[model samples]
Structure formats: C-alpha cells, structure tokens
Target: MARWQDIEKDAPEFAERVRARFGAGIHKTIATLRKDGSPRISGSELEFEDGEVKFGMMDRSLKLLDVRRDPRIAVHSPSLDPPKEAGEWLGDAKLAGRVVEIPPAPDSPHQDAGHFRIDITEVVLTYVGNPADHLVIESWHEGTGWRRRTRE
Candidate 1:
C-alpha cells in the first residue's frame, strides 16, 4: 500500500495532474462492494491532506457499511464532457485502494460519521493525445511503479 506522498515522490508531474482532476470539482464517485458480492456506487468527495487521501461518510451510510465489510474501494474524479476539440479535453482520474478507518475528532460536527484514509493500490490518468486521434493512459501501481499506454 502506498500513500499519496509516495506517488508524488515517484512521479511528481503525473501525480500533480491527477490531483488537479480531483480538485477540479467537489463531487466525485466511489465504488464499493455489496454484501452479496456485487458493486455499489455512491456520491463522495475526497480530501488530500497531510500526504494522505481521506474521505468521510454520514453515520450508517451504506457506503461506509460496505467499506467496513470489505475494505477494497475505487474512486473516480468528477467527470466533465470532452471538449468540442478533443485535444482540448482535460480527461479524468481514478484510484483504487483499501480504506483504513480513523477515529473522528472530539469536536466534529458529524460526530458519528465514518472517516477513512486510503492505502492506494493504483492510480490512473487518461486523456486524449495530440492530434486528437488516440488516447493516452498513464498509471501508477504499487510495486510496479509507473506505466503508460496509448489507444486509438
């Protein structure tokens, strides 16, 4: 498992772009596993603080319940439509990891809310390439570090 700082250390530019995508908007999406082994999607927001990626859920939120039952999770940055000129598009980012629960602070407003920090397993950034004819995917994975691929 790697922290956000590890990515910054290994691939600073790529990490910066990925963080920009997440920071572009406040609302993102999160995926979790249901009790029956299916997938569930929920609205979420992420906070990058102190070299960690953290998030919170309302008390007894289904998403929080799912995480407690199964730590595996995936998060997608807020989406935006591709620009009229494909080359102008900013693309999007995604990350996969396991959540570790943290105790809420004593003076918190949402006192019983679930708080967590992710131990990232993977991070990906996908965007349209030059000439607007292909797609570029740059990804970072634990142990393997960084890799890039292109698709037509």
Candidate 2:
C-alpha cells in the first residue's frame, strides 16, 4: 500500500488532472451502504475543490440518509463508447471513498441542501480494451492524487 504522505506531496498536479478530466458537472454514480448492509446507488454531480470531492443533494434524499448511516461509498464516472465510425476514444475511472459531511456553507447553493465531502481512499482506472485491464490501482486521498498501492 502506498503511503498517503507521499501521495500528498504530489497533490496539486494530480488534482489538476482530475479537475480537467472529471471536474464539476460530471455525473457520478455513488454506491452507498444501507443500514441493513445492502447497497444503494444514486447519481450526483461532483466538484473537486480545495483538494476534496464535494457533492450536494436535497436534505431529504434517501442517499443523504444512507451516507449518514454509513460513510463508505463507491463512485464511478459513466463511460461512453466512442462512435465506431468516427474512431473517437473512450475511457472511464472508478473511485471509492469515505464520506465526510461538511458543514453547510452560509449562503451557499447547497446551504439548505446537504453536502458531503468524499475522501477518496482508492481508485481504479480502466481504458476501453480487451479484458479491460485496470491501468492503475492506488490509495488516494482528497488533495493528494493516486499512488501505486498493489498491482491488480
């Protein structure tokens, strides 16, 4: 497992890449644990700011409740296949993290709405190819980028 401290040293560049590739307004599917240990999946837009991934939702949503009960969550960016005729390229990334509820910012868009910051604990990157080998697997944290953990 890669140490978070080492990863922290390269946070800025890593965060910049993530922001450029999968920044705000990008749709992410989050899988949260239910009270009974089942899974609950939902979609939300994610913003990476100040080294953290933040998501907002209505205060009354079941997803908000689910996270409160259990902070473990998995997030994936939806993949779109490039047009075969056009020969466009396609790729996708998956992230798993622990959720931390940030205090509502006064006069913020989500003030009345609820917001949660996800401290990414791990990440897997996959490209469109035969067998879909994971290009990278690492221990990641908010602010810090991904660091090689174990080979997959």
Question: Evaluated with TM-score, which candidate comes out highest?
Answer: 1
Off by over 4 Å in 2: 1-8, 11-21, 85-88, 128-152
Candidate 1 C-alpha RMSD relative to the actual structure: 0.8
User: How do the residues 1-152 of candidate 2 rate in per-residue lDDT, one tens digit apiece?
Assistant: 22223333556454343444454336778898888999988988886556567778788788888888888888877655555633233445667778888887787876767688776666654433333443334335555555653233
Q: Which stretches of candidate 1 lie over 4 Å from their true place?
A: none
TM-score of 1: 0.97
User: What are the models' TM-scores?
Assistant: 0.97, 0.70
The number of the candidate with the highest lDDT is: 1
Question: In model 1, how large is the Cα lDDT of residue 13?
Answer: 94
Local error of candidate 1 at residue 95 (angstroms): 0.1
- Model 1 lDDT at residue 129: 95
Q: What lDDT does each candidate get?
A: 0.95, 0.63
Candidate 1 lDDT over residue span 11-125, tens digit each: 9999999999999999999999999989999999989998999999998989989999999999999998887899998899999999999977788898789999999999999
